[model samples]
Target: MDLERLYREDHTFFKVIVGDFNAKIGPRRTAEERHFGTHGVEWNEQGERLSKFIMTTHTIHGNSQFQKPSHLRWTWESPGGQFHLPDRRRCCSEVLHGIGPSSPPR
Candidate 1:
């Protein structure tokens, strides 16, 4: 993806990409601690791909950076109330300063 290429070629500026990736990203794993947090739902095939992209590009997963109430964590819910989809945000760690559950808005 262009974003991946940008991450690989540039290091002069902080990068932050936020959107609904439609990937679960599941919970945090030992190897992905830097990029993921422990408040995710479940991992799936798409989540695996997204995880690989984040690792290879050396980006942080913003959705997992802070703890949130269950209601606030998920971005989408099924009409029947059977499923919830979490959004994903990929950013460089440098861009994450002062951004957290308690951090002031920039």
Candidate 2:
């Protein structure tokens, strides 16, 4: 029904999501804030509950299962103010981090 409910009820372990979500969330400590066009709305008490759910639910681990366990990789591509569609590959996220412009040029 809500973000807090979804993050709390449906998540068990390492629920990694990869997609184009145009909305931003909190605990606002992530890196997606430095850019422009980011819609930082009030998740409010519901958002806070959900944030807590995410923090408490996630389990940080260190194992030999994979190499390069980084959260993000830096690309030379700039944010916002662009030209073509086929050349684009990424979007802004609440958890995502970068110091660039907001939305690309249309």
Measured against the true structure, the TM-scores of the candidates, in listed sequence, are 0.59, 0.24
lDDT of 1 at 70: 79
Top candidate, metric TM-score: 1
- Candidate 1 stretches with Cα past 4 Å from truth are 77-106
**Decoy 1 TM-score against native:** 0.59
Q: Write the per-residue lDDT of candidate 1 for residues 1-106, one digit (tens) a residue.
A: 6767767787777887786667888788786457888778888887898898888877788877777887776556668877745554643445555679898777
Instruction: Assess each prediction's global lDDT (C-alpha) against the native.
Output: 0.76, 0.41
- lDDT tens per residue, model 2, 1-106: 6644675677466565333332234224555322211233334564444345445655211111224334442224446856466534465445645545885554
How many clashes would you count in candidate 1? 0
Best by lDDT: 1
Global lDDT of model 1: 0.76
Clash totals in order: 0, 6
Each candidate: RMSD: 12.5, 17.1
* Candidate 2 Cα outliers beyond 4 Å, as residue runs: 1-27, 30-39, 59-106
